[model samples]
Target: MIRRFITRQLRQPLPPARPESDPYARALPKGDLSGGRPAVVRVDGATKQALETGRTRLLVAAVSFTLAFTLIGWRLVDLGLMADQHEPSLARSLSSDALETGRADIVDRNGIVLATTMPTASLYANTQHIRNPQRAAERLAEALPDLSPAHLRAKLASGRSFVWLQRNLTPRQQDRVNRLGIPGLYFQREQRRFYPHGALLPHVVGFTDVDNQGLAGIEQSFDDVLRASAKPLQLSIDLRVQHVLAQELAGAMTEFRAIGAAGVVMDARSGEVLAMVSLPTYDPEKPAAAPADARFNRASLGIYEMGSVFKLFTTAMALDEGIVDLNDGYDVRQPIRVARFTIRDYHPKNRWLSIPEILMYSSNIGTVHMAMDAGTPRQKEFLGRLGLLQPAGVELSEVGQPLVPSPWREINTMTISYGHGLAVSPLQLTSAVAAMINGGTEARATLLKQDPAGAGKGRRVVAAATSEKMRRLMRLVVVKGTGRKANTAGYVVGGKTGTADKPSGGGYARNSRIASFVGAFPMDDPRYVVFAMVDEPKPTKETFGYATGGWVAAPIAGRLIERIGPLLGVAPRGDDNELIEQMLVDIETNAEGRQLASN
Candidate 1:
């Protein structure tokens, strides 16, 4: 009977099955309305086997995917949760326990915030958890206008679990984003360095990077010290003094129409830096926005031919070695000729000038003659001792390397006498000045506040008598010579004026010049030495169209002393006019005054 039934079933033509392309693959098709009954067909054995094989393959693939996801999750949890191995990330990587993680605040001597690091939250998202990427991104985009909707959509739609949306967002933005109630968004804490004073002490305190890494200035030099200690990094800079210096320097820059300006105020006794400024400085809070030139630290880093300032060193060397006496005179009536260059005075005396008068008049010819008398070997030896022809020992990131002649030929000796050929940084000049004033001690500069016991306890660089004579000569320059404009009332200011034409290709530019004034206050009891300089100041109506140091840089230093004296607690003393009789002589003052009366 079974054989007979099978034969009958085979003999009957089996209905064909519907294709799977139909809306319901396994469903039966409706019958035609022409009175045909609804019909269905069963699958043959071969077709049934194919369907079973496809189902088994799909199940295997799904199982493999699940196992892969499980293994990936297990590994991630293992790596990220091993906090004991990574001592820093026990709770989070932002913890202060990590070495070099959190730096101490940088404070001025008075404990004002020049630099500090603050913890901020950064927003990220897990795209795998994002159900509706478009809606979530739309909401996030509204909260962060900097983000484009389409780009945020891609970020949300990405398969990544940890994608950054924004870092260091503002508090208001964070609050607003939290209110939006996005599901997959998360926050991670990070350190953001801030400079509240902005550009006030740009070169002194310096600026950090976006990641709180030290990039320049003091920040870079003392980074290791800062990271290791929680105590405030106390600097020699007083913010008040820094502000006064910056305000005065910026104003002078505007008044003189200078291309650049730099100034420094140092303690003549201890070599403490009170205020130093280099402009046009940029805001440390936004260092990337600043131009390349604005980032240049000119005060300590720019080496220039600082015209007559070197004469101080030359005269001191001559006197300390007994090569010349205060009464020894040099015939500066004629221009000095060597090889192709001539050393000549701008305003010549055309006669013999005493040692003191030579510096007082800033006679280039007289200085050259004095150096020749001192000889090349002695000149080199003296300058080497004075620290004039080398890198400054100041604690700064951008100290300029002095451009001294390697061979130091006879021409070099002559040119250096007139403050040319050899170039030196302003910081080198400041240290040299302090050496000349502090009873001839060579104190190295430091940024850290000076402790009673420190390494800068200096060695003697010159004789005390030589320092006294140099002080008188510096005073003479301000009282009766080219630096007359630098004499402040009751300040007992002493200094020399330097007007140097900037060197071009192999020669000095004809019209472009640098105006500089280096001074010390209370010359009789020297306390502080200040150096002010202007690069390429243009002729102005107020200056009587003069671009010399007397017209530009001298008054700037005088004004700075006036502004900073009270701030630094330097009480202004009465003018030491009693010493002027011996300090200034043959100053066209006595001779010209008599001549005017006789006429």
Candidate 2:
């Protein structure tokens, strides 16, 4: 009809009819012959008017059609390109529904995903377009009974264009929800971060929000790195090693009836964190549902008076300052009388203890004398060199500040020597031990295992010779001293044991101690350093009314070593005394002092 109308509206006037009065006359009577020159009859005025109007109408119609077509093309381009960026939906940014699409998975050093991103479908609906909001909601609630219909109704009544039903549903649920076939409902592909290992490494592999924003742990620390790259992130953590640590620490925490537990396993040479476990840990997959207590990462964030563990640092200082020799003896029989404070051992051994024996027995008196010889200035400087008295050298943000006595008095130094007046985080202790055992090169503990060819550079905190001596002494402590319980059959583990009285209400809390053990495996050539701590452990029948580090933390470390050694490439050297001596000579030997020089 429109076409016909246009044709009629645009039709031109017909040529004036040939004169019809007479054939010859109408055709050309007044002018000469029709075929010859003089002749056509003139058109009437009405014909002329009709012809002019038709031309004007056709021109107007042509212009209008061209302009309308141009506008339609312009709008098409705008909708296709401009609207996508300028008027993006809230779902695009607020919900993980958009960003998680095709996100890379998170894997451990051994390609295990303590956390992973799985592709899943999210359910959403437009309230205004639903056929029957109440009925639809009922169907949805039935499909996912976890959702309440009242809540669904309120959400559907929110009058919003889009409301989220759920993000990242399981395939079975998605199929069920789809079976409902409710109008205005839709599914969006989303990536959900799933922790396959559950609570084992929650503190290491962090969780992500619905939109995949890292909320905690390594996930939060490296959120930007994960979002920007497609490749799987390889954390320095070994999942298998982490499991063993958790199992052993949990058993110890239960046996001793401790409030909490924490531990770490770091590669001494590269400072790579092979395994780190913080008890009371939560599952990363459901971080929101976890308790805050379970979420606290004690290994990296919690700081405690890690008792005689600091003795390692003091002895290192003494050796580095040339304040004491292996053969040099200090009289530990008399408790050092310094002002109001008195320094004594847990089980005092009254005798002239050599440098090795002082460490072997964890003698407070001998350690105080050793610290005094090195002096406050020298001791503080040496600890600072080892990254104590400050945050650890790692990428993690939850670092605990070391609690050093401000006055730096002689009494304070004495107490701090036995690991009492000072507090350091577990991470700090492990990193310091890594510096001591990894050939004296101080590398900050790393959660991402670096490619050996491209590993980071390190700062040498102590001389190679001093580091070797410290390692030997530490091994002696594990072999015959407080840390003897930590020795595993296959791994020539050497470590130190510590039991610190917890401070309470302006003074030390008697009978309350933080028991801990720090060890390194394959003593002849150190590989990994393991540190475990149980806070406020109570004496149990199994422990024989003792909660010492040797009884509590050492056994845990020993079990962890035995289980993780095979996985960590550490061979057993239970009878390799010759190899053990290569790192730690027998302190009782007459020529022990000459062994270092001979080697």
lDDT of each: 0.82, 0.80
Stretches of model 2 off by over 4 angstroms after superposition: 1-102, 453-457, 574-576, 579-599
Best by lDDT: 1
lDDT of 1 by residue, 73-108 (tens): 988887899646777556554444534566888888
Per-prediction TM-score to the true structure, in the order listed: 0.79, 0.78
Error of 2 at 58 (Å): 44
Cα lDDT over the full model 1: 0.82
**Tens-digit lDDT string for candidate 2 (1-599):** 33554456446443444545534323445455344544435455554577777788899999999999999999999888887565556544543543445345677788876666777899998888886788887888999998999999888877778999988899999999888878788898767888887888878776788888887777888888877666788888888888888899899888888889999999887888988888888867788898888888898888888888888988988888788777776878898777776677778877667788889888888888888888888878888888878987666666667888888887777777878777888998999988887778876888987878644258779888888888788778887788888888877888999888888999988788899999897877888899999988999887799999989999999988888888977777645555346324445563454445547
| TM-score winner | 1
